[model samples]
Target: MDVALVTSLKDGMNLVRYELVACQDSKRGVLILREFAGAAQSLGAGAILVNPWNITEVSNAIGQALDMEPEKREKRHNHNFLHVTTHTAQEWAETFVRYETILSMKLLLLFLGLLSLINQFCGTSLPLLVASSDIILVY
Candidate 1:
C-alpha cells in the first residue's frame, strides 16, 4: 500500500484516508480524495479534493500531490493526524450525549420529521435509529 499517495475515486465513508493519516510515520504523504466522499467533509481542509468525473482535474491533483513540498505535506498531515487522534469514539459519544441533552424540542421535532420522511421513503424501521454526529445511515 503506497500511503505516499492514496486516491479514492468515490466512496461513501472511506476509512482509507484515516488509515493513511494514522499510518504515516513521517507525516509526509499526500491524500487525494474524491470531493463527493463522506470523508471529504472532514479531510478536505488537509487533503487534496478532486472530482472523480473530471479526468483533467484528477490528473492535475495527482501532479500537485506529487510535487507538494515536504513542509506542506507534513503540515497537512499534522492537521489530519490531530483530528484523528482527538475525535475518538469516546469523544464522539460524549458529544452526542451533550448534543442530544441540549437539543431543543423544536430541533428534535425537525429531526424526527426528517427521520420520518426518510423512513417512509427508504422503508426503514423506526423502532431503533442510530446516528453519528455527521451522518445518519438507516438500515
Candidate 2:
C-alpha cells in the first residue's frame, strides 16, 4: 500500500499560513483530502476535513471558503505582451510556414558548421604526436 502526501501553503494576512494536505494513492487512482488547517492557533484560520469519496462536496466547501466578495478586494487582471491573438486560416498558415522555414534553416546551418569543424580537426596532429612519430620511425 504505497501512499504519497502533498502539502501546499498559502500565506494570508497577519503572518498566518493556511495549509492544504492531500494524500494520493498512485496505483489505485485515489485522491484523499486529508487536512486543510491553519499553521498557527491564534489566527482566524479554519479547517474543512473531508472524505475522499465526497469529491464534489469537498470541492464546493473549499471554494466557498476561499471565495471573496468583489467589493471587498481590488480586482486585478494580468496581461502578457507575448500572448498570441486569434488568426484567420491564411494568417495561421503563413505563421506556421515562417516558423518552420526559420527553424529548419538554423538547424541546417548548425549541423554544417559542426561538420566543417570536425573535418578540420580530424587529421591535425599536435607536437606530442609528431615527437612520437619521429621516435617510431627511428626505431
Candidate 3:
C-alpha cells in the first residue's frame, strides 16, 4: 500500500484489484503457494485467500475482495502496511545471503531442488530462472 495504490486511496478511489500484484499473490508462508515463492502469510487477514489452480475459487475471491466492508478494508490495509514497513522479501533475501554457509555451491543445488516445488506453485506459468543475485523477485 505504497506509491500509486495508497495515492489512489488518498484521492478517494477504492481499490478493486491490483493488476501487477493481485490479491491472490498477496499471501506468504501460505503453504499453498510456498512451493512457488517459499513465502509465508505476510499479508493481513483482510485478503481474500484462494487457490489459483481453482478457477471457481479465484472468481469467488475476486467477488469477496470487491465486496469487502470499508471497516475491514481499513484494518487490512493497516496490517499490510505495518508488515511491509518491518519485514520484506528483500530483507529475507538479505538475511539468507548473510548466512555464510548459504552462499556456498550448495545454494545452487538448493535452488534447483526448489524448482519442482516452484513448478507446482506455478501451474501454467513458465519456470522462473533465478540467475541474478541482485534481483529480488517479489509476489
Candidate 4:
C-alpha cells in the first residue's frame, strides 16, 4: 500500500490532492487498486492535503471496500460453518463405529473363555463344543 500527497500545477495555481493506493498479489497478476476518480472516491475536505499521515485509516478504508465487494462476499458464504460442521460430524461418526466393532470382538473372546472353563469343570468332552470351538478358531 502506498499513500502520497500529490500537487498538480495548472495555470500557475497549486492543486493539492491526497491519493491512496492498495494492491495485493493474485493468481492472474498483481491486483492494482481501483482509481479513486470512479464510483468509489475519498470524501476528504481540504484546501490542501494537511492531515497527519495515518496507516490505520488507509488500511481500514481498503478493508471495508474489499469486504463490500460482491465476489468476496460470495466466497465467504461458500465456506460457512454449516458445511464445515457436517463434514466434521461424518468423520467423527466413522471413528466411533470402528471403535465399537473392536469392543464387540473383545467381548466375544471373553464369553468364549467362560464357556471353556465350564466345560473343564463338568469333565465332559462335548462333541458340539469341540466342533464349534474349531469353527471359532478358524474365524
Residue 112 Cα positional deviation in candidate 1, in Å, after optimal superposition: 24
lDDT, candidate 3, 1-139, per-residue tens: 2211111212122223322134333332111111112122444243445545566765655566566665665566555555555665688888887785667767788778767657676875564555456764432
TM-score: which candidate is best? 1
- Regions of candidate 2 where Cα sits further than 4 Å from its true position: 1-86, 125-139
For model 2, residues 22-60, the per-residue Cα lDDT tens digits are 111122211122354232232112233344346677676
Estimate, for each residue in 110-139, the C-alpha lDDT of model 1 and write its tens digit.
789877867676764455455769876655
Taking all chains together, the TM-score of candidate 4 against the true structure is 0.28
In order of appearance, the predictions have TM-scores of 0.64, 0.29, 0.38, 0.28
Candidate lDDT values, in order: 0.77, 0.36, 0.45, 0.37
Better of 1 and 4 by lDDT: 1
Error of 1 at 19 (Å): 0.9
Which candidate tops lDDT? 1
User: Model 3 shows how many backbone clashes?
Assistant: 5
Which portions of model 1 show Cα errors greater than 4 Å? 1-10, 101-139
| Model 3: residue 136 alpha-carbon error in angstroms | 41
Indicate the residue-level lDDT of 138 in model 1.
58
Question: What does candidate 3 score in Cα RMSD to the true structure?
Answer: 18.7
Q: How many backbone clashes does candidate 2 have?
A: 0
